[model samples]
Target: MKINAFADVSLRALLVLSSAPAGELLTTQNIADAVGTPYHHVSKAIVRLRELGLIDVERGRKGGSRLSQAGHKATVGQLLRELDTRSDPAECHSSHGDCPLIIECGLRGALARAREAFYRELDGVVVSSLPSFRQMAPVFQTIGLRPGM
Candidate 1:
């Protein structure tokens, strides 16, 4: 199942924040650049993540975000569930009209089950453990942070 762009950006931003050293925070723009996403997209992702209590944001000229303690323990599945707001993977209704097969579509249930299965598979994976610091050297470097410095 394909995730939405917001979910993708949220995951990327979280991964970037997880790679930072303790006490090191990254601004929305920095995260956007690191993830190769537009600043506005990353900004929205940051706001959602902050609302979910996944990242802590400090407000000020020097303000930035860092992975929160909850973020470290959050599972990929949990984060995705929070980020992906769609109840149905396939939109049955559109400006034109409802899908012709909306009444008897078996694809909907199948897709929903598949999406749940996908989330189950990732439930064991902690967000912070997605990549090791050594493995994230390049990602950190992309954000102008030297790993292990």
Candidate 2:
């Protein structure tokens, strides 16, 4: 049930962009710094997010990134599904063909159900739901993205 760093950074970047000043473009390096991720990692996440239509990027001297309309409405689960590469809840390690319980064991099904339940819970949470404008203002300020700028 552990989400990878890519998924975590994707959410953080989206949240950061969602809270940024209107029409203000944010650099990926700035975002990476803010989220404590590597430059290349954030860059890759940005590309993936754009490919998913959850974010928009502008190139050139004034190049930067921002959350798109889809991003604004995206649920936590939706983003995770898009960014998380892990498909199976549990790995089948019966390559040796020695395990007899592999075929009948309920562990895999149980894990899948558990993963579904986790996603279901996350579906109720919007990326922008928990951190209020009031809560985000100070954070934005710290990042030099002051309110009303």
Candidate 3:
């Protein structure tokens, strides 16, 4: 299954915020730079996260974005579900009745079960359990977050 870039960015954003100091507000540009995504895309993802009550945005010079609550209680599954995006690996046309062999296709069932297992694994992971950004400094640098930014 291929998850969208939005899911990647959302996860990164949450993980970054989880490592940041409590109540520290990070700008959209900051997040964009950290996630190696466009500013507008990060902004849109932030809006979605806000709508889902996963984040709170503060507007102004001293304002930015922060997690609505601690990361300990936030599961990766919650973020993925709130994104409402799909990561389906197979193009089973059973929904549109386009595939004549869908009824007998073992591939479809296997893919579906695999997808469920993928989400189940994700569900078991909590944001707080992830290594801190400081610990992943090399990764952040590789993703374009300049040192000390």
Candidate 4:
């Protein structure tokens, strides 16, 4: 049940954005640095997040990104489901060829149910509440923002 790297980076970007002061917009590089991820990966995550309405981005010299109203209220399950773009929980086709069981396998159904259950367990978990401001302040400070800023 491992999520993909893109989904992981998107979550990390959200966590960093959620820690910022209200209305504060953070540059993609700043977020990348804060999360210890590469700038390009964070940039791609930011674009997808904005497309999904989870974050807002402005384009200009002073422009950056911030959590949208939707972002603040987003559940971990919701975002993960959206970010994890796999059509099937398991791939029936491999380099060897399609599985003979693909036509009649009950495993796919079971796996789908299991994946949904995993998401349901996280439905009550809000992304913004993952780490408190105090917990994130030190990381933000390393990126040049003040503790409460």
Candidate 5:
């Protein structure tokens, strides 16, 4: 299944923050530049993350965003679940009006099981275990993103 850009950006942002010293604040634009995502999109994701209690935002001139206390402990699956509301991979009608094979098909159930397995695997990966920009320098370079950008 394909995860959306929002999930990618949010995860990248969290990973970037994880690499920094605890309490180090990163501005929305800084995260956008680092992750090579649109600034506005990062800003919106930041707000959503903040509301989810994964991040904390400070106000004013010296203010920026920092991860919440649980951020490090927050599993990638948790983050994805919070950020990805439409987690279902199967397309089925609630009233059984759209899908003719709702009663006979096992594909939806199989896909759901696969999706759950995928998330279970992702749950084993901690945010702190994510590769840093320095570690992924070659990849960043290949994609034209300068290290530490």
Candidate 6:
């Protein structure tokens, strides 16, 4: 149940948006630089998050991104579901018939349970509960935000 690098950046992008003062729209490059993630990955996450209705993006000279209302109240688990972008267990075990143990293995079931438990644990956490970025003073400056934003 490991989060992929894309998902990791997505979560951080949300956290960066969540850190903003209300109504602040942030550029994806700012988030990428602030989180130390590649711009490509961060841009992809931003687009997906926008499509999922968790964030909003507007184009134009003064345009940028901002967390939507749902984003503000998003649970870690919910965001993970949107960003996970992977299957549980393995494709070989589920439908490919690529594994000899597919017929009798309990591994898939166990993995499913473990993944559910992991999400259950994460569900209790709200996005706002993530640590404040205020601790990273240098990043705030680079992101064009004031400290404690």
Model 1 clash pairs? Answer: none
Model 4 alpha-carbon miss at residue 87, Å: 1.4
Ranking by lDDT: 4, 1, 6, 2, 5, 3
The local distance difference test score of each candidate is 0.86, 0.79, 0.72, 0.89, 0.74, 0.80
Reference-based lDDT, residue 115, model 6: 77
In angstroms, give how far residue 8 of model 4 lies from its true place. 0.6
Q: List, residue by residue over 26-63, the lDDT tens digit for candidate 6.
A: 88888899899889989999999998898989998888
TM-score of decoy 2: 0.85
Best by lDDT: 4
Rank candidates by TM-score, best first: 4, 1, 6, 2, 5, 3
Off by over 4 Å in 2: 94-100, 133-138, 147-149
Give the runs in model 3 whose Cα sits over 4 Å from its true position.
70-72, 87-89, 94-97, 136-149
Scored against the true structure, residue 138 in model 5 reaches a CA lDDT of 56
For model 1, residues 58-139, the per-residue Cα lDDT tens digits are: 9899999999999989898988888788877888777898899999899999988999999999899998877676677887
Task: Please estimate how well model 4 matches the true structure, expressed as its whole-model Cα lDDT.
Answer: 0.89
| Candidate number of the best TM-score | 4
**Per-residue lDDT of model 3, residues 64-145, tens digit only:** 8887864446888767766645444466544666667657788877887877777778887997568565675764565454
Models 1 onward score TM values of 0.91, 0.85, 0.76, 0.94, 0.79, 0.89
Per residue, candidate 4 scores C-alpha lDDT tens digits across 16-124 of 8987888888999999999999999999999999999999999899999999999989999999899887877888867898888898789999999999999999889
Error of 5 at 100 (Å): 2.9
Give the C-alpha lDDT of model 2: 0.79
Where does model 4 exceed 4 Å of error?
A: 147-149
Output the lDDT of residue 26, model 4: 96
